[model samples]
Target: MIREINFDGIVGPSHNYSGLSLGNLAATRNAGHVSRPRAAALQGIDKMRSNLALGLVQGLFVPQPRPAGEWLSDLGTTIEGADRHIAANAMSASSMWAANAATVSPSPDTADGKCHLTVANLKTMPHRSHEWPATLAQLRLAFAGDAFAVHGPVPPAFGDEGAANHMRLAPSHGEPGVEVFVFGVSGGPFPARQHVEASKAIARLHRLDPGRTIFAAQSEEAIAAGAFHNDVVAVANGPVLFAHEKAFADRDELVAQLSASLPHFELVEVPDAEVPLADAVKSYLFNAQLVTPPDGAMTLVAPTECRDTPSVASWIERHLASNGAIRQVNFVDVRQSMANGGGPACLRLRVQCDPADVDPRFLVDDAKLDRLAKVIGDRWPNEIASDEIQSQSLVGAVVQARAALLDALELSELG
Candidate 1:
């Protein structure tokens, strides 16, 4: 029964383009543009449906409450009184990127034979720092069974950005795996969000074997080129590691180490000559979801932008034509998320576990997606302009919309 269930974060009604993420070029570039929350959420639901059609298990996380009223109160101000930057932080919906939710170690790789999840502190960004508590609440509920163990955020002194910076290479979902934790020492032009110390601490917390665990430094050049998190430049699934040429600080050494440590390991590296680093980051070619479907060849779930970018498109065609490790390429539209520096890979947190052990409410089906879409269409705002973030009317609408989703889901403790 053990399988990989991708838990995608539901796009919130407060989703906007305030450019809260510092190193993410897409978010910064589209800072003032209008956002379509309804469209965004629907798009996410459709993405989940697409995965389900591919015979992949799919789960969901409700959006964290916005206007983060309590967080704002601690800063000695309310949403209306806060400055534009602060106000935007208060209403940020960055939680939609579930990849940042937690670092998951499947039961097969853990010492106790139970899956472990450590919520990310996300201390680098003011808007994201307060997310752990809400994220922890959801994880606790979804994985309450004995087959799972959910840990709180690591100490704030060490920054941890979760699964977005972590990857596992294994023979299968139910087998012991080699886990890699990628951290940034210095982001160069951008701030290094994941600390090496934090990554090591998580390894201990999960009780992973020292021999099987790895701590890799993210490349400064890559981060400087807008590859903020390791996920932006690489992704791992099954025994394959798909990455850009400059993803790691020490690419050859890391590959040598991985090849020596893991069996049946395959590397699908895209040389910068084929697709330059700038274009790779812009098109999110490496951020694509690398998955092994239940009944099909290994697949790459990438964004439409990758298909549109000339260099990236050419590379993908060649990859497909060669019968590469990624046998199928499926393109999905998440422009709403893409504009904010998140792509298909960013939208999900992969958990390898038995479906029966997980809370059924978090799992979704086509019928359930239909219901969720109806709620989104009826309640989610059609558009969110930058200037309207502070309007009491919009705040009320956003708050009400979340409540409606919670009521419909029937398990929310009120995010």
Candidate 2:
């Protein structure tokens, strides 16, 4: 009975929005589009969708606090109000509303049966000190247990260090049993020497994995060329590889190491597209989330542009119908003003579901729980035979066992 799970969404400041009209601001800053007014309107729609999705997922949607000042007054006020409104709606929808806290990027940690979150702080440009402590504190508290393990934002041996925007961690892959492997920057925009030091820190950490980890070094020049931005956006499973064409000069050696040590490893080649790497990555991640299968097969949903561009939709439709188990993948006509992109899974994070308890046929209605129980009983007749086990006795045992597990985990204190 996993009741609570934490997840982080990218939300914060945008310096590029400065001095622009709301429409122009969103177009230039958020969507990177030419139609300023349309983009602004779309931003509103995206925000609403983001809120609804977070609410549905029963997870916290943490955003940076509104910055003070007249210049950002209107935008800041709107975002603040939106956050409160969404949170209220979410609470009303679920009795299991856990907790929501504001912070910049959170530190990474793992604890048995609980997820920890760290929000990215965008207020203090390029500085780690402003929000790291608070982020770390929240993560520590959320994942307080003997099984907790600190994983990311690997600090340098000496001096202050900034956290990387992209890195690998488990749970992100939805693979519970695999060893966590980390990659990405150790420091910030720099003299390259700092990156070397950061790389060294990663190398030391890599040694901890023996043959189980792989580090793909993307050159400073490539990262500067907008590689890091795209990589971060595209990451669905693990760390974004920021590599130039030549960066894989040591590819064979790396592959050999990965094959020897890691349960899985592969170097992915990114396509050269007109869109910014970040945007491309966003689109990739968006699609990935849209069509995740229960059996873990990779599937792609119909493209959003399918209505106007049938050619693109047909390809995905054919693929899904012929190769994948997707029952259907229709292009949903969403309000253009939303802040969230992607369908279904992209918007709603799956918090908890018992494989033994979940009934695929379960419906959402007043009698949903009862229907689910009935379906489970039908599916596993032997496990619930009336002659062998009385219904009341089973219920009592389940309730007692749940209470005992909660007590052992000390979740009562959290309440």
Candidate 3:
């Protein structure tokens, strides 16, 4: 049977605060703060466990090679001798945000009746541009069978930010769905990362029905306010699409098109009056994982920041008081990721496929989580101060930590 499995990236030992992302407000604001890599990874593991308790299946991707010495060398310098900014970008643990890893099309939505995954080129940011090759290798390893097709990436000329800008709305996981591709043209101070041409290329490559697919424009206003990716301001699961009021350039037209296509589409749009755009982006209010557990009503897995922010918290309370599209709210502590400009939703890539078809090693059970935690607690660095990123000892530990994880999981080929 087809099921929705959320594959979350394990936070890397190199996870730090270099603020490599320009459009992400949270990252820029917290650029030089000391980071806790150990805590950050443990937090991610805990998130997967919590979701498991909610009766959701979970999968994981190991952090890619970091202190990317090879990438720096390709750029005509060594890690220790390169410009600090360039070196920092090479050491980035931003790979933890797996939502940008790929845009997945489930078999039900594809003409070939096979799940398809297209890894994002991510050409807009230098730190992220080198990620696709690693991400592609992982995807191929996990979904190597005929049940799935893993494509490399769109041309580098057209920037593709992956699943963060894509949403699928289906009546059920096994049924056909309408895919929405949200692209941005202007981000004011920041460059809009996902291009329309990239989205169209993915649609054609995925073999999706043109009539069922919708290409919507992301609002410039929201992007300028720091909602860099579409998922930052909107997300969809099953029959529901939860978004902030200022999410789209043409909200009315998008809603009409969706309603006309989907018989049970639920539009749970949070109004600007209740929670303004600034608060929405600040608290990552709309970046929640809207999931339908085994049998219960859909629930939202949000970051703790949502509860801390008064307006977002109040709006959530109001939504829960009545029977809304999302009935329960689960506030998880992923502050490490949040402070670096991501939240619960940002940490995962949703793939619709049978759990049996995926590489068993990537699928996590309680025992796997326990084993993973042991490796992390033992080898992951305790803290990563910006000034200390260049330390040889720190670099050695970061590399060793990743290798240790691969060894524990018996997937040493990745190392």
Candidate 4:
């Protein structure tokens, strides 16, 4: 049986707003503010539960160890001896945004008919560059069942940011689909995170049909305005592609190509007049999670920030009233994550496959969620001040808190 499961990363105890992600407006604006790690994790959990209540399958990925020992050592210092900035970046729980987790090819789309996932290299940012090894370890353990095939990321130089740069479109979630890989060149003031070569290599590695795959470059304007990842400017759900007018450098050509391949698909574009590229970035309108359930109209799960933005919220209302596959809009409060440049969609990765093919330890049921909520509430810090990043006491607390979280989920092996 085919299913779409959302694997959300368990927010780490070290969650803080360091503004390390350069192209992220929210991160830059809230650079040194205090963060509520416990609230952040629970907010994510609440979003997961909401999806589950809507009859969606949900799963979890254990957080990677923070203040990564290996990274500190690479810098020729131990965690205790590292500078405050280094320590904060090392312990950043940015991995909680699983959209950058990996690029997945469902069974029906790959040549082998076995689900394939390649962990992202994330070489664009220094703090995130060290995440792949740890992410791969977790992917291996979670998808250990025979039905899955997991691969390590491409070499560091190509600069792959995984699924955030890739989107799948099909008549149905279970069918073989068209994969659109969005890459960008560095011509803007801000760095273009996803490289064209990396996207192509990943498509080849996944063995997707060349005829069904398309490569498109993100617009320089979007990248310069903080659309670092393609997901920040465009999102796809089944056959529907919701995007901004300037999302791609060659929008018309790309749309023509997509229409040729997926004739029946719909393209819902937000023109610059309705919401400028800068406004879109500021509101994260395109960062919303678009999902088509098994038997209902498509739904758009947007962050509360969208509703707060007059232009974005108005545009959404107007768009929904007009005509499109997206019938309903649900706003979720993920302010903590939004402050770090990730919205509702950034917190989870969507995998279309059978649930039984995954490790039960990674799946979520009401019982497991209850336990997770309890553990997060009990252990996660209520406040994490930026200045406290160097405190030995705070570091120790974060370490112990993660240990307790892993133990709660019976995932001590991740430690």
Give the root-mean-square deviation of each candidate in angstroms. Answer: 0.8, 15.8, 0.7, 1.1
lDDT of 3 by residue, 1-415 (tens): 9999999999999999999898899999999999999999999999999999999999999999988877888999977787889989988999999999999999999999999999999999999999999999899999999999899899999999999999999999999999999999897888999999999999999999999999999999999999999999999998789999999999999999999999899999999999999999999987889899998679899999999999999999999998787889888999999999999999999999999999999999989999999999999999999988878899899999999999998889887
Q: Name the lDDT value of residue 28 in candidate 1.
A: 96
Worst 10 residues of 2 by lDDT: 91-100
Q: Which prediction has more favorable TM-score, 1 or 4?
A: 1
lDDT of 4: 0.88
Which runs of model 4 end up more than 4 angstroms from their true locations? none
- Each prediction's whole-model lDDT (CA): 0.94, 0.29, 0.94, 0.88
Backbone clash numbers for all candidates listed: 0, 21, 0, 0
In the range 190-258, model 1's lDDT, one tens digit per residue, is: 999999999999999999999999889999999999999999999999989999999999998889889
Report the C-alpha lDDT of model 4 over 279-340, residue by residue, as the tens digit: 88888888888887655778998888888888888898998888667898888888899888
lDDT of 2: 0.29
The TM-score of predicted model 4 comes to 0.98
- Prediction 1 TM-score vs. true: 0.99
Cα TM-score per model: 0.99, 0.43, 0.99, 0.98
Candidate 1: list runs displaced more than 4 Å. none
After TM-score superposition, the amount by which residue 120's alpha carbon in candidate 4 deviates from its true location, in angstroms, is 0.5
Of the two candidates 3 and 4, the one with more favorable TM-score, higher being better, is 3
Show where candidate 2 strays beyond 4 Å: 1-6, 10-16, 19-58, 68-124, 127-129, 150-208, 219-222, 233-256, 263-293, 299-415
| Candidate 3: Cα lDDT at 333 | 96
